[model samples]
Target: MAASTSQHALVSAKSLCAGPSFETRTSKVGFVSVRRCCLGARKLGLVCASNSQSSVMEPAQLPLSPQSGSTPKKSSESALILIRHGESLWNEKNLFTGCVDVPLTPKGVDEAIEAGKRICNIPVDVIYTSSLIRAQMTAMLAMMQHRRKKVPIVVHSESEQSHRWSKIYSEETKKQSIPVITAWQLNERMYGELQGLNKQETADRFGKEQVHEWRRSYDIPPPNGESLEMCAERAVAYFKDQIVPQLVAGKHVMIAAHGNSLRSIIMHLDKLTSQEVISLELSTGIPMLYIFKEGKFIRRGSPAGPSEAGVYAYTRSLAQYRQKLDNMFQ
Candidate 1:
């Protein structure tokens, strides 16, 4: 992690806010709302608290398997929490949201809160967010709900380097902190020419089917942007090389990024085909949890589904847009 040049500020904030931190009281309201359904057991409480502390303090380590054919050693005790960012400005504008770098709208903020409300239970130790503000905001809000604590998340140098989040977490109650990592591989799909264009207008100019293909196809890149396949190549490479190993070490991981970056990962995790992968939709702000044992991904909670009401609300919530994606399936 790169040290902040303001030796005065970083060092000062570090002193004032640092310690074995706990979630602030305000954050607890949402936490109680979501996890109240399952906290009855004393054993569960101990596991929850212990997982939180251990995941926060320890260095995650996992190695390659010793099988005849080499492969990464699979995680025995890992759970992955994948979250798409809350709705963004472009999402509400009925525009091609590819790589526009927009922040969330006011309603989007509520969606983020609702999202946090939804995933407040799992012991999420580290959060990985895209450098983009919308995703960053989503991660912060979700963590607050998850822990009910307001630990200041300072972006470390390496986190900034990869457009991924990484660094330390200091406890308000203890003298310890944990690090978060960020990477550009988590960035939204980069749309070249169609980035900010109105989806409807683009459809009219180019045949609607062609436009649909651009948005939902795995191999076809729109004028200047990357195809889903391109994004997957980069995203999965990072996941395999950097992120998966962490999960394999029995760590709980939180990934808050854009639609396509996440879809790229989903494609790898679920082993969907190129054609099939394009039809996948990750609802904004919803946390999709997957438990991994051995080398295989274990699905827990919900399967992939259509964008929720909140997601399309950002994308203008148009009937045609909804219908278009509906018809794109295999």
Candidate 2:
């Protein structure tokens, strides 16, 4: 199949809180309410947790055999996988975690491990992540299950000395390593004054309607923070300027970041309208795949497993490329 002709499919299904007081108990109630609201939104599919839309293209059964005398086509396209970081401390605490750096909770850690297992068979040549520790941690943990079993090294190009010191001398080792690039542009939408606030409390104080508008609306930002639109401006721009080139060069890429930032990127990839983007929820630790071919992105959805028919729909060239890498490790 021509790379451009293949449709993207998202597969796989089945994918927190806080707080305060007039003095004490009020905060706890507020936190519980906030947690319930977030959970309720997910249950109602109001949040962009996972793409529920089915692909028009059906998945072909695996163990694909080459036709006699037919050469497999080399793919000029590459795979792009996007994963939101696992739950953070604030995520579990039901706090308005916009842009506040926090580590993942234990559940979040397990989520990353599962995410890694899901994508282990898919080739990942490069990685992009936000500057936050949660995002960075998720990327590393997920990579732990990669079948390639290569070390993911952070690329330190900030300073001449740092670059020189971080350089790998062995070409063989470099071939087995994936370079991870971190950028603030990929950070979550800054929640502004709401960063550390409990969600339900904020809603109680600011009105549920107002909080909804700030969180779901494309343009309106919370006090002192970036709106989804503002976040898309930088996140999508960075994807185009930095990440897209890598994909164009036929490098399979994986991106680990925050929800809103990934949503902003998805808004661009899926050509979703502002209103449409509001309902596009992404589940934590789930990997959504896209094929960058002929200058367009084809969504392949989330793969249910490594051997799932749609997960690693490689072109002849891609299969060969993977074989070459595997042989190196052998």
Candidate 3:
């Protein structure tokens, strides 16, 4: 969907679940282990700590449903978070990882956890990730710091049996679980022959200008590989077809993907020209936020951190949601 230019007010914040006794004010909140809560709750769960706190906030009313395929409503507003996966093993090694599926480095894990804490108070009903392990790991690790404590379960819809086998039997369990959909279309740009190659060595062999063009040019592809424009085709198409419907349905969505794929989506969201997009750079594990309302995407910039006062004040709804968290855990 194309973005709207007219000014629109942010929607009211929805009430999140009340659970856990973790310290939201501390920077160490991201490092807190939820292994016990997760193991006990199951469902690929990572739950927040629980205490004697009682619920004080009522759920926010909405004009539209948050179900998977609900129709779009102009009055509805939802949060859309885009996170580039943290540093992968190949990244640390300075290798071209494109579609190679490397795991995250230890620092990458920390980056993802930190990214989670920054947006823990924000609502996230659904998650979309790339088919790569690095992106998937980042998403799961980040959710561990969420204030809502809902379990994120990977939806296995690729095959009939896979879907049936992964189904939860209890309706209550479904309520506490967020669906994580993985799509190859959201994967990093394919590097073709450059996969597993060291960046410096490739640059030395191919010459710096040629290698730079292959990496940074908007439409020039490396030998037998995809260019930024080519990558944008599939990524933006998937975002429009699969993700926009969720936002339209009022579901809060998070996307964990690679630099190129996410840049492609951001180019679409921000309506950047091909030349502008080629120069865009996304730091690993830093999540960018956009408010989806009235079928338009409004870029709110990257959230600073959970402790930053302005982070909550980005919108009235976000501030209310944080206040509810404070009340629930106080």
**Candidate that scores best on TM-score:** 3
lDDT, candidate 1, at 268? 69
Write the residue-wise lDDT of candidate 1 on 1-330 in tens digits.
111222222233223323322112121111111111111111111111112212222232112212212443442455577888888888989888776678899887877777776555454546777778888888877666643343424334442343233433333422223245556777888888998899999999999999998898888999988988898888777766556555555555778888889878766665556765565556676666555555555433321122222221111212343354445532
The local distance difference test score of model 3 is 0.71
Candidate 1 matches the true fold with a TM-score of 0.65
Residue pairs in steric clash, candidate 3?
13-317, 20-49, 20-50, 21-49
lDDT of 2 by residue, 104-217 (tens): 999999988888876776788788899999999999999998877888888765666776676676777777788787889899999899889999999999899999998889
Candidate 1 — number of clashing residue pairs?
30
lDDT of 3 by residue, 194-306 (tens): 99999999999989999999999999998999999999999987876667766776778999999999879877776666876676667788877777766666655456676
- Each prediction's RMSD over C-alphas, in Å, is 18.0, 14.6, 12.7
Candidate 2: minimum summed lDDT over ten consecutive residues — where?
27-36
Candidate 3, residue 241: how far the Cα is off, in Å? 0.4
TM-scores of the models, in the order given: 0.65, 0.74, 0.79
